[model samples]
Target chain A: MSYSDLYRNAMEKATARDAWKAETIEKITAMQSSHKKNTSVRHICFTAFRHSMVPLASAALIALMFFYSKNDFLSPSLSDSSNNTPYVAAFSANDTASIQEQTAPIGRSRSIAIFPNIVEAPTPEQALPSDSCSLDDAVVSTEQYDQAVALLEAQLMEQSQDGTLPVVLTKSDIVAQGYFSANDTISVVFALPATSMGENLYYVYEIPLI
Target chain B: MEAILSPADAVEVYGNMVFRAAFGIVKSQQDAEDIAQDVFFSLVRTNPRFSSAEHQKAWLLRCTFNRCNSYFRSAWHRHTTSLEDYHNLPFTPEETYVLDTVAKLPVKYRQVIYLHYIEGYSTAEIAQLLHRNQNTILSQLSRARTHLKTSLKGDF
Candidate 1:
């Protein structure tokens, strides 16, 4: 026989396994019911995920930035107590009205002495002294500031017309002036409108004797 | 134009053809069968629209070519397997001798020889299928024919 005839006959004789063919048929039949197979679904999902990668990363980065900035602003000042305010720690349910009363004159009487009419308040050892409020005096830690803020926030929220805290809090609104000489206490000078609509007021809080 | 073959029909009709083409290059029954399955599965997955029965056949052949190339390039196919076991292939002694001689040829020569001699693809058609110049295929075919003639001198 010729080389061509021999090659053709041999090539034609090769056959596939019967079981494999049956398995392939079964798989193809399954495809009729599942128009979208796992492989195709994976391919589509992978392509979409690939294309949206940039936007997803960008959104994550923006969220991270917001988190860090919020933390930085709200971070308690453990390093510089002299320059920090003492009144944030002085918050008490009994002193709310007195604080509001002292603060009533802020927008009108910027030069008036603060905390004059404070009721049942302990005086600090030295007002505006070089050494200021300490956590030892306030009995509050920097980590607990969130709880403190939440309490203060809720109080302010009730007085607020819209019942929402201001989005931004600046250093000008709350300040720790000094430790008073009367009772080894520190005083916080606060001046701000209760809400955006309320009048700006001034209040001095002598850090409670606790 | 003939109706396009369904996945099952295509496998039944072209499975042997694809296997032979794949085996000509890879020279392994296992690899050839795998390549054939891949070709048919791809058809089932894509369900490609073809102009005619010849178009479908050409598409399957092209897929077989690509799949064989991929198999050859894989790390698993790095070591060459012996063809001694293949001596007992399902063919007469003379036919098996011819198949073995064809399998021993280099891949490029084997590819062109199989397409030209066994599949009856013209040199021009193979050039189009393989994206090569017609003259290159013609040259490869000539060299392959000479090598086969030299190896199986008395048979030729």
Candidate 2:
């Protein structure tokens, strides 16, 4: 047979063998159905928690931003109209009171909701020292962080008038160690371990003593 | 103008075409199948609208070309494919000779050759499908034909 004919015959056979089967098409259809499924009810704040380490890394970064945030929410330059990434949302959350009002208290992040009050670019002599807060060398290791945060959690547990503090302590390490000197109190960030399986998520607390 | 195909219909109709084009580029049955799956996954994910059946075909072919490039660049594209298994297929001597010669061409040449010769796409259409310049497509086709002619003892 001719060159085109011979190649065409073999190519057709291979192509036929490799072609999509009914089962594959059904799978694609099922995938399409799932990809198109609308889950509008759940608040979509899991972008930071996409990876296990991501939450820890993000918490450390958030603590950093809380420490040194310029408090320039209204600066047209920092948050441009085009930059719509989650980073911008986080920066903007620290930048504006109104956006924090609307978006804080979102999902479990209960994450950054507490930031606006404390992290809104503090002055050197502010009543609360939110601006100086960070996961500094005080938290030399996870071991040190657990000890510091555990002490703070225990202290805060005693001070709660109602059982509002979710301080059910599991071994899951809390996030970045940040603290501030309030006029009469010392505040710290800690993890209230999930009540069941032994993974901890980030939480906040105020311990008045040293 | 034929009716535009739904994404599922497009996969059914064009899966072989996508696989063959991907095979021509990647030179592996497994890699070609993977590229085809990735192409259809994006197609299903996007559910992009097309104007006609021709548009859908062109879109699938374009997606195949793109997926082949990205997946080939990916680390999974280790060049350990053994084409000795292809010989086990029931090909006549001439067909086997043609397949081997065609596969021996450089990947770019092989791509244009299969699209132009076996799939009956014009160099212009192939250029558009492969997203290379028309001149580049023509040059590759010329070199491929010359190589095939020499390899096939002037049969091409």
Who wins the TM-score comparison? 2
The TM-score, computed over Cα atoms with residue i paired to residue i, of candidate 2 is 0.53
Rate residue A194 of model 2 by lDDT: 47
Q: How close is candidate 1 to the true structure, as a TM-score?
A: 0.51
Q: On residues A1-210, what C-alpha lDDT tens digit does candidate 2 reach at each position? A: 678778888887777574345655776665543333211101132233333234443455554434324322212222222221111112223322222211222222222323322232222223123222221111122333344556654444443334444344333333433544221223345434344433233334433221
Q: Model 1: DockQ against the native?
A: 0.19
Error of 2 at A23 (Å): 2.7
Candidate 2 stretches with Cα past 4 Å from truth are: A18-20, A38-210, B79-84
Looking at every candidate separately, what fraction of the true A–B Cα contacts under 8 Å does it contain?
0.52, 0.53
RMSD of each: 28.7, 19.7
Q: How well is each residue in A1-210 modelled by candidate 1, as lDDT tens digits? A: 689878877777665344556656665565433333323433443233234443443344343334322322221322334433332222222222222222322121222222222223223333222333332223333322323333333333343434233423443444332222111222334444444644334344333221
What would the per-residue lDDT of candidate 1 be over residues B1-67, giving only the tens digit for each residue? 6888888887777777887888777777777877777677667555678998888988888889888
The docking quality of candidate 2, as DockQ, is 0.20
**Weakest 10 consecutive residues of candidate 2 chain A by summed lDDT:** A83-92
The regions of model 1 sitting more than 4 angstroms off are A16-19, A35-210, B79-85, B154-156
